[model samples]
Target: MFEQIKVFFMKIWNELIITIIVGFFIRSLKKSKELVKPTINELLNNIDYNSKNWKEEIDKVLEIKTTVERHFPEYKDYLLIQYGSSVIPDNKLPSDYDFIVLLLGYPIEGNRYMHNKGTISDESNETNKDQVDIVFRDYLSFLFAASAGMPYENSVIYNGKLVKGHQGYFQWLKNITKNILFDKDFLIRRFKEKIIAEKQEFHKCLKECEEFGHDEYYVIRAGYYYITSILQLRRIQNFEKVITQNQVIELSKVRSFYEDILDDNIRNKYEQLVENLKRNNTLDLISIDDIKEVLLYIGEEYDKNK
Candidate 1:
């Protein structure tokens, strides 16, 4: 009877030990998940552009402003603006941000100097990989580009929150943006430049693919560029401003046109390539020629419609 009692207690003790171990593991897992996943506010607040960490860079730019004003007194009035993905309303988790120093007066030498020397080269090299971009723009060129429905039209002028600059200048830019109207000639010019640029980049990506192995990511990117380029051209031809973000909404229509009218496998290949890229970061499934063919088809179709 004593032996039986000892065995039963031993079994109970063993089960209790196992239960404690499992409970500890579960608690640890929950804690790990909590640590790994950040809240939306935390993610946004931690962005490099908004973070206090980039204050040094911002201060450097401000110092540069002093140097610029001293050297080129004519360009004393200027506005430094931050825009791009960082300022988009719905873009809560932007990869990085873009800053533009807009000069009101035409101080060519000072503008060039700032454009060439405004950045920390080493930091920019690393930050480029992280998606940070900075540029210098004269007010006239900025106005022209904004009127032409350039991609930067979608960006917001930073309102003294992250970077320190003239609030009056920032407000001026906002007002100008609000009042700017689309210019057809500039839109056409921008469209041509866009097409040429995308084509050149596509060719470069193809060359890299041939030299190295095929990269699914580049292939998918090239496909998207081609589609968007075509859409932009069509819009320009119709005297409409290019709608940049609605591609996914129009994907089915584009696919149907390619499949039924064009009777080409480019759409299927593009879809598959995108799916493969999403599933696996590294894929060698697509060919350079495949992208070239699709681009060629798009070009031909654009010409036909134009």
Candidate 2:
């Protein structure tokens, strides 16, 4: 009788112990999920830098470092950087928030999932509130870009602000960028590609404008690209270092400095375009032909130089 009682108690004890262990495991998993829950994930799609709420939107974007770190702790050396209009105010509403999460080491298989998780849904995202663009790149790719003197990589080296990561890593990036051996062929090809792409987009916008009423948004964007391509071509032609976006845009407005690049005919047209785009939200005063002429001039100049 005593043996039977002992066996029954032992079974009960075993079951009780298992129940305790399972309960503890469940509680731990729930706690972990809570602990790693991203604070920015909920707010990620709500960031906006419109004229009314730019200040608040900027504040929210600045907090992305913590979330990135928590989610991507596997890679110790990474840079979370902000560039483009998000960092530099160009007196117009930014098309989107640009960010680069540069992993400063070898790529890992797990990084695929990490990248997917942080990828912004900009294409299908109808609302400008979540118009975030994230470019995830590994060290090898970044190094190659720096070596080849790619414009965006160069801009990050020179103008990008570090939202998170070691200062040493960013400094190392700058150091490599300083000694970059620019690939002339690569640059020429890039310039050609940009000119063609912009020309197509500009013409498409013009067509849209003709079909619809006035598309100030796309027209302004085409102007922005035209100015950017012009500036980049100037750098390539002169073998000068690349400048910041704001500096390039500002310089484009001042035709006096670019007398050598812009002939009398092109300069007059460019000046009118710049004046209209800079002063107001409307494009009534600027002639569509002016944009076409400026683009043609740049394309001819690029061909000659290349």
Candidate 3:
């Protein structure tokens, strides 16, 4: 009789422990959801351009240009291509100056060569939020990349405006940009490369999502790139110039096509993820499996098209 009583009590104790553990897990999930709610709300509603400091921001960019010119006088013939949020009109909190310093009269070193001069930040003012990213490349290399339909070049060069450069260099860049769209072979090769690169990035994001418990940012980023890649491929097929990368404008341009191409459920999930991310600063609610599914779908589509 005592043995039977002991066995019954032990079983009850084990069951109670499991119930407590399950309760804690559910509570943790709920707590994480709550924590992310406020950030999402703020992201969705904050549309202020904060353009009152435009002159100040321009001054900062010019200062950085002067400093870069002074330091790299040997490359004084470089073209300064300005891009990113700072260049976009009505961009909220445009905080950084992005530059691609293309050195004219330099030879291409083995296809292409790139060197990055890390970001510079102001130390004098506590509230100074200005930053500069200076990327150096030979002019020939830049032209080649643009002509070859390199994904990075497609996104950057097409959107960039010459902030400070010689008239001749600007004209050359403009002509080359137009001519590259006609190179069918180059566009085909570039499309293939983009597919490989995006697939690799998707896998890396999937791994990170599994380990970090947050797939929202990765999913949104992957979805954007996937859609962008598809648009580029379609443009190549139709002999159209790839569109410029104004996130709001460009995304909208491809939205209808993207919606038609992607599975309905995947499309809806991606849209929701983007909406959530735009409002929230943190990644909290997401499913890794969903991200993987979308990525796989994108890859399959690319394969079929290629």
TM-score of each prediction = 0.47, 0.45, 0.49
TM-score of 1: 0.47
Mind sharing the TM-score for model 3? 0.49
- Consecutive 10-residue window with the lowest summed lDDT within model 1: 120-129
Which pairs, if any, clash in model 2? none
Candidate 2: segments with Cα more than 4 A from true spot: 1-57, 61-147, 164-176, 212-214, 227-231, 238-257, 268-287, 300-306
RMSD in Å for model 2? 16.8
TM-score winner, 1 or 3: 3
Root mean square deviation (Cα) for candidate 1: 9.8
lDDT of 3 by residue, 1-306 (tens): 999999999999999999999999999999999886432113213433366654334434345456545544445466667666557877875344456667655333532332321222232122221233355666776666665655455456667777556868767766766534335555567677766676666666657766786534554556556545665565556643453323212423343454544478777655544433333322344455655566567656766877
Least accurate stretch of 10 residues (summed lDDT) in model 3?
Answer: 121-130
Backbone atom clashes (below 3 Å) for every candidate = 0, 0, 4
Strongest candidate by TM-score: 3
User: Model 1, range 5-85, lDDT digits (tens) per residue?
Assistant: 999999999999999999999999999998985432344355477656675556463344764465546666666565544
Give candidate 1's error at residue 286 in angstroms.
10
**Candidate 1 error regions (>4 Å):** 27-144, 151-170, 213-215, 240-294, 303-306
How are the candidates ranked when ordered by lDDT, highest leading? 2, 3, 1
User: Positional deviation of 277 in candidate 3, in angstroms?
Assistant: 8.9
Q: Per-residue lDDT of 1-306 in model 2, one digit per residue for the tens?
A: 999999999999999999999999999999999897443334544556355765445444544445445555555566777775557656365344567777655446767544522333232122221345465666556756555555656766677787666788888887876644544555656666667776777777777888886544456557656655656666565544443333333333343434645488877666666544443223565666666667677766666765
